[model samples]
Target: MVRYVVIGGGIVGLATAHRITIDQPDATVVVLEKEPRVAAHQTGHNSGVIHAGVYYKPGSLKAGMCRAGQASMLEFCAEHGIDARVTGKLIVATDAAELPRLRALHERSVANGLPVDLIDGDQAREYEPHVAAVAALHVASTGIVDYAEVCRVLADLVTKGGGEVRLGARVTGLRRDGATTVVETTGGAFVADRLVNCAGLHADRIARLAGLTPSARIIPFRGEYYELRADRRDLVRGLIYPVPDPQFPFLGVHLTRMVDGSVHAGPNAVLALAREGYGWGRVKPRDIVDEVAWPGLWRLARRHWAYGLTEVRRSLSRKRFAASLARLVPGITTADIVRSGAGVRAQAIAADGALVDDFLIEQAPGQVHVLNAPSPAATSSLEIAKHIVARFDE
Candidate 1:
């Protein structure tokens, strides 16, 4: 029987393992997760938005995966009695300067086959009454779901499909022994015909453990958030987003209505001192040293220091952060918000300082490494699994 071992028990990895078991039922599958539970990193720390494929380029892996995955995710959630909502999103252009980029996004979304409408300020206000916008793109397919619940269900499916998910199994090394791959983990060693690395925060390190050089280094960016007070939830009708700056990968600070009726706002991206650093105080020495020593970090900083400094100020000042949100929803105030937890994104940056945009997957002898799967990755997990499994055929 074909033996496969998937490392890093995030949603994508779990989905990959589950897909493998379904495709090759007689094959043995094992998932090794360093955390005690699944999706403890990017998957669990996400905004839980089911992306509608509007922001991505047409024909790209993200566009296809997001479109297909959202449908699959909805079906899966329904079958499992999970809470999922198709809360349409509004990508608002607040000023005349943003209209061009907003129109470009509309064109791209149409090319990607997503149903989007360009609505005027009055129409935009009709959707989200508090939003201040000159024009907006109403993306009807955008939605949200609890990805952690999805991961739990996927783990159960893997087990029921005759696969094994081993928690607290940190993979330390990988070596090819003849046609088999030997995975040395904290729990124990496992022999497999193939290995898949889905380690989110430490993905680059995992590639090194397997003696493969990854294309980019994972730079952790802490996305700090604030939640709307319960009484002030009406300020946001649904997901309200800014027309993202084309030069940056981040979608600017905006409002998101969670599945449980709570509204969240602002996830300002700033370089984290630690890979898993949720707060400024939770710094790790090694993570800091690695980040400082990386040449790409300097290159990136040199180019974006102006924006970087602004983000740092916003992080330190509650008023500054609230002001950013007010640009989208003019009614929002600092008192209406409460400091919430943060999530660190494993953003991959090239030596040239360009952030890796698309899903990055690399392969070596008997091993596959997911170097960069950020943002909509949770929404794209199932389709990405299908893509990963197809790599074996090539």
Candidate 2:
């Protein structure tokens, strides 16, 4: 039987291993996660929005995978008895300047084969009564779910299929002995005929450990959020987003009504001090050194210093953050929200200083490395698993 070792227990890794168990039932699949539980990092800390292929470029991997994955995710939830609701979304244009971009986004969403409608402010108000907008794109497929629960189910399925999920197994080193790979971890050493790296924030470092020079370096960007006060939850019915700034990868601060009926708002993206940095106080010297050493980080900062500064400012000031959110929902005020948890995004930057927009996966003789997967990754987890497993055939 083929022995496979998968690193990281995030949704993608667990989903990938679960797919293997289904496709290659006889294969011995093992998942190694440093954290004590699955979905501890990006998977658990996200906004839980099931993306509907609204923002991705037409014909891109993100657009295709997200579109297909949304259907698969909903199906999986149904089969597993998970709570997933299709509450739909509104991409509002608060100002006239944003109207053109909103219209362009509508056209792009149409090109991506999404069922989206460009509606006027009056029509937009019908969907979200409190939202302020001159125009909006109604994306009916966007939804929300508890992804941590999904990952838990995926882990259970893998174990039920005779696979093992080794938690608290932090990988320390990697070496090859002919066709076999020896993975040394904190838990114990394991041998694998094939290795998959889905290490999220630390993926690039894991690639280097496997002796592969990845095209880009993983830079963590902390997204800070605030949730609306319990009494003020009625201000947002579903999801309310702004016409995203096309220059950056961040979707801008908006409001999302989570599955638990709480409205979360304001996730301003700032350069994280460490890979898993969730707040300003959490910092690691090595992560800082790594960012400084990478030429791409410097180049990226030079190109978008102003945008970066704005994000930093927003991160520091709650009032500023609330103001940005007010543009989408006029009823929201600084007093209406409280500081919520944060998530760090593992953004990949190329040597040329370009932000890797799409999902990036690379392959070697007996290994696969997921270099960059952010945002819609949770939504596309199942499809990403299929895509990764299909690589074995190639």
Find the candidate with the highest lDDT and give its number.
2
Stretch of 10 with least lDDT, candidate 1: 245-254
- State each candidate's clash count: 0, 0
* TM-scores, all models, native as reference: 0.98, 0.99
- Model 2 lDDT tens row, 154-211: 9999999999999999999999989988999999999989999999999999999999
Model 1 CA deviation exceeding 4 Å by range: none
- The whole-model lDDT of each prediction reads 0.91, 0.94
RMSD of 2: 0.7
